[model samples]
Target: MNRKGYYSIQMQAVCDNTRKIRDLYVGYPGAVHDSRVFRNLPLCNSLEDKCGRYYLLGDSGYPLKTKLLTPFKDSRQLNYNIKLAKSRYVIEHYFGILKQKFRQLFHIKLRNITFIIHFIRAACVLHNAAIDDEFQLNENIDMVNEVLPPEQDLDFVDEEEDRDARRVRDDIVNDLRM
Candidate 1:
């Protein structure tokens, strides 16, 4: 946490299967990237007692490991890499909500590294607490409950349209595979 002088530090958070953030890691200022920073999280003896053990999902900026998740490849893996890849975006969206709601963290007036990271962590804890405290449905904002419906269904479309859309997606996915 002593490292400082760069605004390019990576931030990390462990999310639940429901996509609610269970833990947060603001990270030390420097070259520590997602993969290493992610694995460095203090692990507990039992996953039941430890949060985020469902898995660590991160962006391509993060490294891939049995303990951490990233995009899938045809390359052999011990687990289902493809599924984790599809789900990692939730963490990115969580970050978006965080920055949007707590803008101060992004623009901490304090120059000290510990203060910057600590302030962010404090904000995240508050945010998580708010989420934990409030379970009411926000109908005015069209906000859904914490638990989401399984495998959201896309807009209703004809079979032909769906097939064509999927073809385009498959093409893009295939291109990325190359």
Candidate 2:
């Protein structure tokens, strides 16, 4: 249980530029830190092999790795941060779309954790299928007024930044400046 006195599950997902979920990891308790949950994900183990020349964008809660790029804490790289934020919007938008389609995700009432995990995975798969089929939602449905759950606490202990990842980030920032 989290400090908020509610049981929760932590879910992690990786989406492509098209807003389709490429990978997902869930079933972690809500009390677990974001970094810890990410590290335990199967995708984290094969990230290097899965993404050869590409890097995944992550928020500050995650450690900067060769395959995963987190924003620099320093404010000098404003342009780089801005560009990264724009690119990162795809994943955020995917979550919004997922919740909009599967309202059960907003407050899943299933008592079985395993079942909840399966249900979430099924929703993701169906979401991808819907995208492939070019399914459109009703225009009359109010998308702006949907109330979402409160954001989870994301503060985590800073992991040691990989020197190679730092160098890679620096190169990208320099390239952005040119």
Candidate 3:
């Protein structure tokens, strides 16, 4: 059982606009916060060196970093938030498609965390292969019904915002306004 009082495994993945998984990190207990899990990822450690000019769009649960841009919480930046959400919708859609195709992911009966992790990875690999084959999903499939964890914890507060990250986000907001 996790902090949310349920049995769950934390899986972190990054998918491209093409709906292909680019990076995957799994096996963290559900009790862990997304920000903490991301902070521990090897990808997070080397993101600056690897991404160069690219920036990853993350929800407010993640800390704003040079390579990872998160949405601003204030209502004043609604436009920026909307644009970011639209761009980040791909990952959410990908997860929905994955769960719909692999129904077992909804409720894995496995008890061993290691086995569960491997199982999830195998599913991801198969998902990529399906994408490679250009398999089309059922047109009627409803991706919106997929249950996702809450984006922000009402009780949790983030630390001080990074100056550089805030500047980058503000610049994007300004661009949107222009």
Candidate 4:
């Protein structure tokens, strides 16, 4: 329950990890799965849409691919992360600064899902503004075309976790109805 007995919402953000502005999304309580956010976040969609080779830096939350790079979690098979170390680190370091700026953002305390969405949008918009006066984005941005291991060969073990995650997401949303 929130300060008003309503379940608060959580906002998830995905960025290049070094850029001033991040692609953001607002989700309900208990919706912490990275795949969901990755699938739904408009920012990722927009960025990925732009033509040319674009590499999205992210953490363990989002799915791995040639375009969207993340740190090496395991050494199984030929992982693209082997050559992606430099570019991925940029996002990691930026995330640290983002968290420092918005401490309460990690635990957004709000009821209305719409308001929660707006709160995140507003934060991102401000960050976007800050970037205008700050260093230019993609200044040292790394752009490498490290091919991905065959999709069929790479392992993904989130089905079980996703099932439990969906249950919790449903519960939280249902609880809000009351």
* Candidate that scores best on lDDT: 3
Please provide, for model 2 over 63-84, each residue's C-alpha lDDT reduced to its tens digit, 9 standing for 90 to 100: 7787898777766676776677
Model 4 per-residue lDDT tens digits across residues 57-164: 555556544345454455542333544544555555555555556676676777567877787677777666777767454434345445333222123445764455
Can you write out model 3's per-residue Cα lDDT over 1-178, one digit (the tens) per residue? Answer: 6465458889999998778999999998887888888877899778888778888999888878777888776666766777887788788888888898899999998878889999999999999999899987664422333222326644433454467778878887787888
The C-alpha local distance difference test score for the whole of candidate 1 amounts to: 0.53
The RMSD of every model to the true structure, in order and in angstroms, is: 13.5, 5.2, 4.0, 13.5
Clashing residue pairs in all predictions, respectively, total 0, 0, 0, 1
Estimate every model's Cα lDDT from 0 to 1: 0.53, 0.77, 0.80, 0.54
| Stretches of model 3 off by over 4 angstroms after superposition | 2-6, 138-161
Rank by lDDT, descending?
A: 3, 2, 4, 1
Show where candidate 2 strays beyond 4 Å. 2-5, 136-161
TM per candidate: 0.56, 0.83, 0.84, 0.52
- Show model 4 residue runs off by greater than 4 Å: 1-14, 28-32, 41-48, 70-73, 76-86, 135-178
Candidate 1 segments whose C-alpha is farther than 4 A from its true place: 1-6, 17-19, 44-53, 73-83, 135-178
The candidate, 1 or 2, that scores higher on TM-score is 2
- Best-to-worst order by TM-score is 3, 2, 1, 4
Model 1 steric clash pairs: none
Where does candidate 4 clash, by residue pair?
A: 17-91
